[model samples]
Target: MATNRSEKTVSVLKIAAFAALTPMLLAGCTSIKDRRGYVMDQALTTAITPGLDNRQSVEGTLGQPSFASQFGDPVYYYVSSTTEQRVFGQPEIEGHEVLKVAFDAAGNVSSVTTAGMDDVRDINPDGDKTPTLGRDRGFLEDLFGNIGAVGAGGMGGGVGGGTNGS
Candidate 1:
């Protein structure tokens, strides 16, 4: 009767709803691939010559570097990375490259070195606090620790120290 047709309609609607949502649910589990930093061009990078290429020509060849050395010899670092990330997950480096171009005192390229993921190192710090020679202190100790230290160190002419205020 009419009840049997209504039940069939409800079942079909349920299937249609699931079909519409199946792709969306799968999309959440899919990984997102991203490329960050400098895009490497093999031809242009290889064209850079140590003795021939200077800062200006190098910049023209490879564009601006990711960073440069602040001290010591002038070195330009071109860094690139490809990472994959899932929903609510940290991005993992799938590929990484670092090109180091060193310049001599004359600002001409001295050396060109390339590093891959094999050179990448994960540095896990030892907890949040930096290890120090001093003893560990609590919250209240830190807040009030300097209370007596300021005047305790031979601060002359205090209440009980210098000739009792003669």
Candidate 2:
């Protein structure tokens, strides 16, 4: 009887210990993310050759680019990234790529370039002031600019702007 009771207590302790640790183990598990643009297949991307693949062919093969340049040269960008976010923490970038395809003025494929995250650059604006051509107004000018612009509401001919037919 003593041996049986000891074994039962040990089993109960083991179960309780597992139950207490189960949540902690699950909490350590993290979520992976395939974000932004779709993942580019190596073979498919390699098949795209500049000067040979035009807009139509490129679209037909690799699909539309993640973004297109708004300025000159008409460049298309294929951006892809994989991120991992931990519990209650900002996501960390695991992989990133920027594929640029330039189109000639004639609308043909001009060149293809591939760059990693190291190529990214942050732009810093030149000055604190935005530089406007208009004249600057003082605080008093702004505060009193609209003074006397409006008259007393009682001077209006119609009280409610409604006319009753006689």
Candidate 3:
């Protein structure tokens, strides 16, 4: 009985140790701050004015930009992304904030503008809401259309329907 008790105690201790250390181990792996350094570097590179120095240079230090325009005046964008992840799962974006800064000919800050969650547009903005081009058919119409020849099965006829008109 005493041996069994000692074994149980040891098992409990191991489980407790794992429970405590699991978060630390996982936190080290999933911490977003580690990944955020690169974004900060990019922002600094694009945002820094050529002639300006110190606070004046960083007056409009934006967080993160979603995109930078490739054409015309070089546009710097700052975007802030919040993501959530579960253990052994993929990370999901929770929120985003964006700022657009345009630099003029001299490379000094020209204009600073900020946009938030509402400013972003969906990739498929009119996905479900947009009306279909053709006459909207009922579910049964679509189902039957899929099963028969005139329903786009082609002139080859259909399964068990025979190739030639007998």
User: What do the candidate models score in CA lDDT, each in turn?
Assistant: 0.93, 0.83, 0.63
Tens digits of lDDT, candidate 1, 64-162: 999999999999999999999999999999999999999999999999999999998999877877767879888999899888677665766465546
- lDDT: which is higher, 1 or 3? 1
- Candidate No. with top TM-score: 1
Q: Residue 26 of candidate 3: its Cα lDDT?
A: 78
Lowest summed lDDT window (length 10), candidate 2: 157-166
Cα-based lDDT at residue 12, candidate 1: 100
* Candidate 3 structure quality by residue, lDDT tens digits, 72-105: 9867776676777766667766666555677776
**Model 3 misplaced stretches (Cα beyond 4 Å):** 1-38, 42-47, 50-65, 69-74, 86-97, 104-109, 112-130, 146-166
RMSD of each: 4.5, 6.4, 9.6
lDDT of 3: 0.63
Q: Cα deviation of 158 in candidate 3 (Å)?
A: 17
lDDT of 2 at 56: 86
Best candidate, lDDT-wise? 1
Candidate 2 per-residue C-alpha lDDT over 49-156 given as tens digits, one digit per residue, 9 for 90 to 100: 878888888888888999899999888899998788877788888778988889998778888888887876767888786766777877999899778755656655
After TM-score superposition, the amount by which residue 94's alpha carbon in candidate 1 deviates from its true location, in angstroms, is 0.5
